[model samples]
Target: MKKRNTCLICLQGLSGSGKTTVANFLASTLNIPVYHSDVERKKLFGLSPTENSSLANLDIYTKEATIRTFQKLYELAFEELSAQQSVLVDAAFLRHHERLRMQQLARDTGALFLIVKCQAGQQIMIDRIRTRQHLGNDPSEASEDLIHKQKQWQEALTSDELQTCIKVFTEEKNWQETLLQRIYRYIS
Candidate 1:
């Protein structure tokens, strides 16, 4: 059998920064599986992706829950990588250690690792959160308050990480195409 090429794309940003959007778009365009923290976290409690997790009487946003969620995401990615498939992971990787975990996973699997740092203005993030809440169509349960808190918690990518990173302005009109082109260029 021919050796298959695979990549682990980590999409990280603040709440409502549109990292999920980028992840979904990339997954569809590239025909790859994508693991999403928001969706998986809710699933852990037997909840639907768009269901109101707030009403589940369980705090899925707790640190322990987050750790478990990221672990699950990594495991899911590992399965795909073991099968020689590329995968995308979507989450707000606020801590440096969270980002490192994914990087290490990529190394362990011998897959090319890339980070897509989705970004938007604070106001834009807040607005997006509000709109998403009103629609209740997204798996994310982030609020406007979370946006402010996330701004304080998010760590900038280190110089070394930037070597394999792409800064995506999700606020831009043609961001999907731009990001796709950049990824194609990088992987080529």
Candidate 2:
């Protein structure tokens, strides 16, 4: 039997879009390690959720910090990939450039690049965010303002990007079935 090459599955979406949940499920089903960008950022920078929210509201310096965080994430991800380990990366990844960088990294490493875009209705997303905030278990770094900004960012996603990526959906259909089908297809 041939061993499967490393796969870098990236979960991208707006706040409350269920990216983290899907990524976690997929990682468990696929038996791959998961790398959450927000968790890595917090670990590397000692950034608590409140501090991350504050940074997101900032204008200039935050961009520098974000870049540094992404660089470290890429470094860690590459190290894992080098060991031929499958990994799932859970991140909002709202920037086109960041996505392109990951694609390049995938090509350079000869790893499979799977982009999973999670989507949901705006109202549903808002409700989920509110519930998460109330429960105080949301690991996302987004605040209310950040969530609003993310919705705006998602609205502007290009159709071309959507077409290229796999969408294991959560909108109108049964999320569990859709996710299961996607995992089945990926592993087979």
List the candidates' TM-scores in order.
0.95, 0.82
User: Once model 2 is optimally superposed onto the true structure by TM-score, how far is the C-alpha of residue 155 displaced, in angstroms?
Assistant: 8.8
lDDT of 2 by residue, 39-149 (tens): 766666565543454545543227776797778768877887888876788888888877777777777888877788888877777788788767765556555567677
**Model 1, stretches more than 4 Å misplaced?**
1-4
lDDT of each: 0.88, 0.72
Task: Assess the local accuracy of residue 73 in candidate 2 as a C-alpha lDDT between 0 and 100.
Answer: 69
Error of 1 at 166 (Å): 0.3
For each predicted model, how many residue pairs clash, with residues at least 3 apart or on different chains?
A: 0, 0
Report the backbone clash tally of model 1: 0
Best by TM-score: 1
